[model samples]
Target chain A: MPFSVSKDEILETVHMFQMQNLDIRTITMGINIQDCRENDGKGTGKKIYEKIVRYARDLVKTGEEIEKEYGIPIINKRISLTPLSMVIDGLSCAEVIKTGKYLDKAAIEVGVNFLGGFSALVHKGFTRGDLALIEAIPETLAGTERVCSSVNLATSKAGINMDAIFMMGRIIKQTAELTGDRDGLGCAKLVVFCNAVEDNPFMAGAFHGPGEAESILNIGISGPGVVLNAVKNYPDSDLGELANIIKNTAFKITRTGELVGRVASRRLGVPFGIVDLSLAPTPAIGDSVADILESMGLERAGTHGSTAALAMLNDAVKKGGAMASSYVGGLSGAFIPVSEDAGMIKAVEDGALSIDKLEAMTCVCSVGLDMIAIPGNTAADTIAAIIADEAAIGMINRKTTAVRIIPAPGKKEGEWVEFGGLLGRAPVMKVNQYSAADFIKRKGRIPAPIHALNN
Target chain B: MEESKKLIITVLGHDRVGIIAGISNILARANVNILDISQTILQGFFTMVMVVDFSGSTVELAELKTLLGEKGRELELEISVHHEDIFKFMHRI
Candidate 1:
């Protein structure tokens, strides 16, 4: 054949873009900002702002160029930085909020959508800076439009930090209240994680870990629509055959990420990090991971056997994606954010999905309790208990899981809480009336698992 | 370097006259060299895929894409120009 790529292959690739919504979800530049630190917290904000603006100046332009040249849509260009606590060690709460403003300004200046890492890692316990950043999260997120915050409250090695979990419960409630008029939109920009990955390209959970290089570019690939179409094309395939089909589809999708990442890295002069194999969904129709599950013979995403289907899908995705890219990290599985995926929203509205069921689904997927809306009256203690439950799963399973639940202030169950755009909207779901106040108040670290002794 | 300047242009629409002629005219004007072209009609739909070397062109890829896009709208056809790397990366190891 004289053609390097056959006509069918070329048309198939084009059909994926035209009909299947395959896209590079994000090109996240992780910039280390330790050099911007100051002992007095005095010129730190200015230095940080200048540093980010300097490093990520051409990020959006580069993303647009790639999108144009490759004829593939790159939906987001974002930046993540070294966890804020380490950069602002011993800094006051005022300094934390100031640095957040600078991050937001830098992000706006660079024309990127979001800037992550107004964050802290307190898996075991909180330092002064960590506690300050956590305390300032509600105000920081409310004060700035594009700054995202996350707190790591647990890890398999360090076990669950119950105290941090309890504090995050209070913080989440406050964040919702802070942006209550917008249906607790602030909570949508905040995430609490267990076993948090260092190079996550997705937000509000993404933060450049201390272990990363000076600067790196990570890619997040999105193609639930592509996978759904692939699975739909093979209605009669057996489960094993279906898995193989999904793996092949994922291989093609991940190659897009690998190609884009390499090009963006070269253009930005940043080290190529990893291709996140997560099938992140959006509010757009036909782009739902839930839809992919539904196409796999499930009536709904949360119905029986949903977990098994999702487990296979997630495993197949990683297996195929790992082969296509040398570096595959982050929460590299299917994300089931209710508000973001129209299929998931419909499932929740139809009472096919519940918080408890979502928690269960989390065990087999990359992230946990994502973009869920609970009743405004849902107690802080209950929210903490939810975090504890998710953290326990991640700890035992040794996988990354996160909670980005919003308690839409003053909204009761069945009411809609709209965050609009990519954040999407969700119906306020009912939470347990029973209280976990006593358990939550007994705030101390949950000891590391027995498996921690292996190393 | 020549390989880097190669592009694959695809035109898809209902079968109509002057589809290739129109595209080739634009490429000829822009000095874009067509290396290979294979087109066919299936189920009354016309599909054309062309491999063009832009190494000899004075116009930028973005400019050519815009010109083709405007022409595509006028002809009621869907035209896309993508770097050759996109196809090779997705379909090859």
Candidate 2:
């Protein structure tokens, strides 16, 4: 038969748009700021600001224009740059903080919501610049509104950097204390990654890798509601059949990303990058990845079969997305950020989900320990151990994983800490009270897995 | 040239008289040519899909979308106008 969209199919898609929350999550313009470096730190910061503003001037406008034309809601216009640690090689921590201020200012000027790549990749070990940037994360994040920071501490090939992980735990705790007035909001803007991808268009982990083009455009598409609605239609279907349905739905969703990415790239005059088909959730009812899992015969999310269900969902999403787009990279899987998803928040509140369950779930999902809120009394070393656990998972599996947990200062377990907007409210879930201080203090690099010997 | 500017306009609302007349009148006044039209009333819910060539229209696509949106609000209908490329790209290879 000739290829044609039937009326029913068209109506279904319309329903997805009108009722279900199907929208483009982000259109990230990756601009290289490596050339903006100067001999003087101040001069380099100014150059970086000017370069980003120049490259991303039309980014927000272009995104808005496309949204109006295509009738698709593009939620965020963002920018990612070359990692600050690399660009500010010889700069001090003060200079790096200044650079972050410039980046925040540029993002505000360009009208983008967030700007990423205030990052350091120390999967093996930290350079001087990397250590300085990591040390300044608390002050940098507290000082800037739109700047996001990430530190990659492990990779399958390079092995886990236990030193960096330990340092990040302390940095995360300090970040929380620095922004304690807003329920440790600084921690929400920071992510700890293992096997971090270069062209990821999502925050708080997106960064421009050295291998990337000078400038490029990447798209992230969101549609957990669409998938959940599709799954609900097949109550009696087998797991294999359910996977097929999700795969088909994901194909359609990724196609929209491809279309939007091409148009955005053409309009912005930048090379088109990947369409990251991640099932990112929002704090709206029915717009939840947890709900999708719950729809597949689970009593609730965080139950026993949840891991297997999430693994299938993640794999099927990637398989379908890979087939739909020619360049499907980034962390293209289901994101289980608790605060961002209404279902997850409810699950946590109802005692159906806990920190341990979320950690287990992360083994199969895209990111780890994401948007989780714990008691303020949780020690720095415990947070470090949490990061170490997540890093180990990513290192062993050879997949990208990250931790974006918040130790809500003074908040007890079951209490709520609201970050507002897309960084939604999170209930402070209980973390293990036992100490890992000694284990964390004995830090060194964990050797690379045997799988890394493939080359 | 006109075919290249094809747009699919979908109108969804409770069944009512003059729904098509109201839409077609605006299209004719705007110098937009209707290439194909299909509509159905299912369970008292009126749904209409129209393919229109916007190359000949006087106003920009953005302006037309706003006008259609206002008309939709007045008629208590949910009207969406999307470029044909979206459907073609999604359904085809």
Candidate 3:
């Protein structure tokens, strides 16, 4: 037979998009804005705006073209720039907010959904710029429509920045209060990360690092529904067999991402960065990471044995994704955001998933305490304590973790706060009554773990 | 092997007469060359996969997709056209 694809293979790929929701989650263009810096903050802001509008003007159009040609839905076309703290270093807080406005205007003009990198890296200690950026985060996020901010407050080698964590807890609350009219929607776009990766294509934690090239295109592949269906197909198969099926499904999914990334790179004339093989879930019914866990014999996502199931699923995804793509980078594991995932939201509402259980689950998966809405009256110190816990996990385990918790102002526990769209809606979950004010106040550093001295 | 410009057109729906003729008519009008075709009734559903070279086609891929989509709607079938590269990348190394 003349080289031809088998019928099964063709149908299998088609069914993934037709019935199952298999789509590229994001096509992020990482642009280094270190060159946009100037002595005056206004000049820096103007240069950054012109540069982003010039560089990413065709990003959304190119994404749409690829989606049309390849029949794959490219959900969001976003741009990530070098961490803004470095660019805004030595600039005043007012200047930083003006830069954010310029960035926001550039994002809207370019037609991209979100522009990331209103960020600071103070994992070890705070620089003047990092402090200013952190202080301006609430105001910037509250004022801008599409500007996202992230702060890398901890790392395995750098340990946890307790002072920054405390500051972020206050900042998170301030952001919530600033955007209280929208139910703390500003916090939805702010992420506090531990061991944050530079090439991460997902928001609200995507930021182009200083180490990245001038311009690179990174692709994040999402196929939780496809994997969930695969797990459901082999109901009678054992766990090992089921894992193999998931790996194979992931291999195929990553291949699609690899193809799309290559095509986008070629068309955009930007170097292809990496395929982030993350199983990012959405608010859709079947597209859920929690559903995959439930299908794998768990009664619910947060009940007993959930951690073991998530660990295995996460490992299998990384293994298969690694084999499929040569240049695999970013947070390439399963993302379990509560509001964004319908199954996860249900688990929380049904009292099956708690913040404590979510913390345990994050140890095995990717990210931490994502899109969780807590009571408005919950202490800022409590939120800082949660970040400290997640940062400690990442520091000891040498994996990326982040906290994107929203303390919806005026919302009590068990009440619903709707952010709508991809940000999704979340029920305010209860937090611990105990305070960690004293502990949070004693701020310095947690010191890097023993493994940090590997040299 | 040189990269193939072939597109796989898969039509999946209830079985009906003149499905192939209708699709082939569109392809022939566009000067497209059909290389191979495979059809089977997969669990009471009519499934057909056709490999066609579109280099000689008169229309662009986007226009062809729209035309085939319109034809598919008329035939009450779900039709999809994909470049062979996607399959090669996924199934092969």
Candidate 4:
């Protein structure tokens, strides 16, 4: 069937751009560095550096060109690589840190904001390289400016790696202490995931999975404000009608992302991977997932009925995005990262939102316990328990979930940590004072859920 | 003759006299041919959408956009010049 553009549709889209804060969030180029591995750590680091700079040289230029021609804002151009641990087998901590610096340098040379995949996947067990990478994270993150890291410590099939989780808890605390002067800013660049997808274009969780092609471009599109505006139009609409509106709006947003992804892929000569249809928010007002939920008729985001609202919103987005694009991978739902969302920050400030309530909301949303700031005194064991809880949700539900919490150093509850830009400012919230130390100290894999036995 | 490159220009602001005239003057000076035009006033606010042929224009798209932006600023209006492809791709398939 032939498609015709209507004047009203044109105006509506233009209005979305002008007034609604609609924009393509990120165009991430995933480069596989598996082949860059060498017999020595220095050789591998040099090879990885050359490969990334060569592949991503034109990324920013192309993104700017597309943004200008399409008249749509492309907020970030980023790169994700094959997990560094895989290429740093048997490497020392210093070698791993050196490799991280190379990744950081390459990112700066290419003019991308961040470079991901300083990661290790130990869903089952950790290798020597994984252990070294984990050990090197605090120094690597503290030493480098643009490198982002993630570790997959759990999966539905492999169960939760309590050992890794326990270690990550300590690593997170040490990272906070090392970057304490900056309100534990290094933790903001790290993520812990369960069932983490390979082609996610968002950071700091994005890493090019082994199953992916050598190189591909994935797009993450966001329009929380657009969805909120659409939902507000139907003040008295029934639940079903409200869901329909969200679905239709997501369809248009996803279509725009697909168009941008295809064009960027063609221009960059890399295969188009997927469009992550996540309602990623920024610190800016009017662009928030929590506000969208509130527009669905809640007095506040973390109050009662918030989870149900979030579940419906996530489902409708997936349904709409699935129809609009041939391929939909990554975390394709509403992200409830606190610092990055204005409504969520307000909800936290109003005492309506707590870590527990955010945890409950994560059971239905795309990610878990994201961008939350905890009091500096929060224990490492408590952080581990938080990761374990979120991982269990992702594992049992057979979906991807992640935690990116920052334990602000020397900051107490009610104080704010300002990370600036897309990292945003997060008001420090309290964590449960009760100890999970004994539970976390039991370092072994939590058995896979019974339902994971699909075979 | 080369086929004319199509463009969409949208102008939105408070209702005022000579808004269209001011915009048209800039387009005429740039050698852009106005193919179709639509304008309306709602709640005392003015909105206009124009489809213009830029193939015969003396300036590039970037230069034309800058020229229109300056005119819009002088008239206290918000103006945007977009290649027609963006609308076609977004509103259609």
Worst 10 residues of 1 chain B by lDDT: B1-10
Docking class of 1: medium
The models' CA-based lDDT, in order, is 0.92, 0.90, 0.93, 0.90
lDDT of 1 by residue, A351-430 (tens): 99999899999999999999999998888999999999999999999998899999999999999998889999999988
Write one digit per residue (lDDT tens) for candidate 2, span A166-267: 899889999999999999999999999999999999999889988999999999999999899999999999999999999998998898899899989888
Q: Model 1, range B1-93, lDDT digits (tens) per residue? A: 123878889989998889889999999999999999999996798999999888899788899999999999999999988888888989999
Interface RMSD of each: 1.5, 3.2, 1.4, 4.1
Docking class of 2: medium
Model 1 residue A209 CA deviation (Å) reads: 0.3
Residue A158 lDDT in candidate 2: 95
Tell me the lDDT of model 1 at B47.
94
Residue A316 in candidate 3 has what lDDT? 90
Q: List residue ranges in candidate 4 displaced over 4 A.
A: A1-3, B1-5, B28-33, B54-58
Q: Indicate whether candidate 1 or candidate 3 has the larger lDDT.
A: 3
TM-score of chain B of each: 0.94, 0.92, 0.95, 0.90
Query: For candidate 4, what is the lDDT?
Result: 0.90
lDDT of 1 at A130: 92
Each model's DockQ score = 0.70, 0.53, 0.66, 0.40
TM-score, cand. 4: 0.96
**What would the per-residue lDDT of candidate 3 be over residues A86-165, giving only the tens digit for each residue?**
98899999889988999998999999889899999999999999999999999999999999999999999989999999
